[model samples]
Target: MAIETTSFESRGERCAATWYLPDAVGERWPCVVLANGFSGTRDWILPDFCRRFAAAGIAALAFDYRHLGESGGAPRQIVDVGEQRADLLAALAHARRDPRIDPRRVALWGTSLGGSHALTVAADDPDLAALILNMPAIDALSGANVEEKRKRAGVSRARTVAITLRLVGAALRDLSRAARRADPLYLGVYGEPGEAFFTDPELAPRFRRVAEGSPTWQNRVAARFLLGAPRYRSGTFERVKAPILICLAEHDLEVSADFIRAKAKGAARVDIRTYPVGHFDLYHGDAFEQVAADQVAFLRAHLGPR
Candidate 1:
């Protein structure tokens, strides 16, 4: 399979992506629309999965959100969940328009925070063929307890003050930009554990490992995103009419399986699989192979020819 560079406009900004197609052309094949996790670009780990999907005779469209990776936007490294959702929709629209893709059999594959976007999109677009979530970052604020955070990585008073001031400034800047409909304010996407930010330092090393290899990956996001992150919720699980496949990591402390299981209780059809590994482990080694095989099987069962 030869992966081709692709681009699309989302909210007036260009979002970059890659399209992987099987050698067997002419026949319109089912496609998977894949996006990465929090503060992540499509260059991380996504290519591995996209290649596997293409090998399975499925077309894969992996994309980077605007302002990250090869995508286009100002104030680089800002993580806006709503804007990401828009990017996913734009990718979906692009996939549907492609001549080699089967528009009616399009499926969504989202990892970590991207999973939240996948569920939210699937809920509203009932025509989607399937949904796959891998250790999604849902309800991020509710995960860490105050006491546990303190134990994980204690913070100095000076660092605390600095973080507070930075966040306050970011929030104000974000508000001002919104008023004028301008680009977002930027900030480091990761912080040490116990610090008030997106991912803990304990879990932040994964970003370093991924970045060591990917030139497109960066550790930044819009600081104003913190203000709206907690309040944003994907309450569309019940409305997601497509078949759902959730691959959960047993040791993942960020996203709780219990929470997802509870919210998706009303879903029409859901298949939940548990892997005995940490969150990032699922991206490589035996765990990655297992997850890929299972996902291929699931998509084959649901999105394959009728």
Candidate 2:
């Protein structure tokens, strides 16, 4: 596959993007956008997913949300939902204008955090042909609470909640300051640095190696993300007009499965699949291939001829 790297502006925010095309494939093929997870970059993970899409003659573009990787933006490491959505919109516009893609047949493939973005984005854009949610997180209300984790770490609920809230507020304030170009930053995005939560997983030793390999592994997330992201709930699924395929990992420790179950009911045109494995397993194991095959099959069936 011949991959091209580039950038685009969304609401004047510059974002990095990449287009993957198969050799000899014409511009008549449908385009797909691959949205990354909470701690992810455009090519942060493996481009194996893009290769699969390319082999099927589907043009795929995967890019970083601004400030995380190559994308340009202030407040590095912040995972604000609104900003990521703007990036997704920019990516869609760039894909549509590309000479090798069929703009009318464009689709979205989201993983983890991107899954929620995909759902929200698809609901607002009616032109999408298909939507794929691999371990989608439409309900932030469903995940493990920061307070609970702190409690388990020997911190009191009141203290933990208060601490987290303060951090979130500080990060937001930092962003506000940056927007105004007030001065060089003193506090970091994590808002008073401490050990990150990704390292606190229950099965740390077992999955640590692969988890550490994630492009965002060493990167500490900004506290502003928790505060900046609109608290997303699955109730909006009713507005999603595109066909959706929801893939869930049965043993996911990051987000609650029940939240996904509740939201999957919103979309009248929805298909759900469950895997016996955990969250990271879907990214690089037999389950990954199995789920990819299912996703490609679903996309092909929906986007291809009868």
Candidate 3:
């Protein structure tokens, strides 16, 4: 397998990307365009999946969304869902135009929050060969059963309310700052209990481990994004015509497994796979192996050399 550094333009900003090519050269290969989850960079856990694809005779393009990682953008680490979707589309266009990739066989792969973008994008893109969502955060906040989620995470009602107030305050403050052309307010991506967006004590270390050596992976994002996040729902699954693979973690604390299962029921060509693990577990160990293997098989079956 071979890797190359590249960039693509998205809404006038340059997004950094890594191209993983198969050993067999001089032939166009089916490609998968990969995007990371919430506040995740291309370097975090995505390289492992990209390497697997390249080794399996498929090309993979892993990209960092603008304003994050090595991507070019000012006032960085903003997580705008709409802009991220645009970045994914731009990455798809870049992949389709590459001579080393089979334009007609380009697939979309997204994990966590990235999966939500993939699902929404694939809904309108009928030409995509396939779509793979790994432990996707589809509904996110809007359609989520917050009470159930909080209960599962052992978070009390008082804590949930407090978190909500903090999030709202931060978002409002960031919005005011934006209007005044000042720097955006930031929020930690993960922290000790009650200190960050994701306060899970056990998962915090795992996230840090994933981002261990990543130079561009920041542990924070613009707080203003929280204001528009709830409205950024991924409800286009039923509109997607391509073959879809949706991986779910039964014990996911970040994304509700039951919500995804219910939302997927409306889709026509979805294949659901459930694992006895949490959201972060899907990125490593036996769980990662099983999920990645299943994804490879799905991609190979659907995007065969053509």
Q: Give the TM-score of candidate 2.
A: 0.83
lDDT of 1: 0.81
Clash statistics: count for each candidate: 6, 0, 0
Q: Could you give candidate 3's per-residue lDDT for residues 137-218 as a string of tens digits?
A: 7665744557765776788899889878988898899999989989988888987444467876677678767567777898
Candidate 3 yields a Cα-based lDDT of 0.86
Report how far residue 137 has shifted in candidate 1, in Å: 1.5
Local accuracy by lDDT, each model: 0.81, 0.73, 0.86
- Candidate 2 stretches with Cα past 4 Å from truth are 143-194, 201-218, 233-235
Residue 100 of model 3, lDDT score:
79
Write the residue-wise lDDT of candidate 2 on 78-129 in tens digits: 6778878878888888888977677778889988889888888998988888
Ten contiguous residues minimizing lDDT sum, candidate 1: 143-152
lDDT of 2 at 164: 61
Error of 1 at 270 (Å): 0.4
Clashing pairs in 3: none
The CA lDDT at 168 in model 2 is: 62
lDDT by residue (1-306, candidate 1, tens digit) is 888999999999999999988878667999999978887787788999999999999999999899888899876777788888999999999999998888999999999889888888888997999999998766666632333443445666676567667777777887798678797666666664223354466666676787688888876566677676633254567788999999988866567666777777778899999999877889989999999999999999988885
- Could you tell me the lDDT of residue 139 within candidate 1? 66
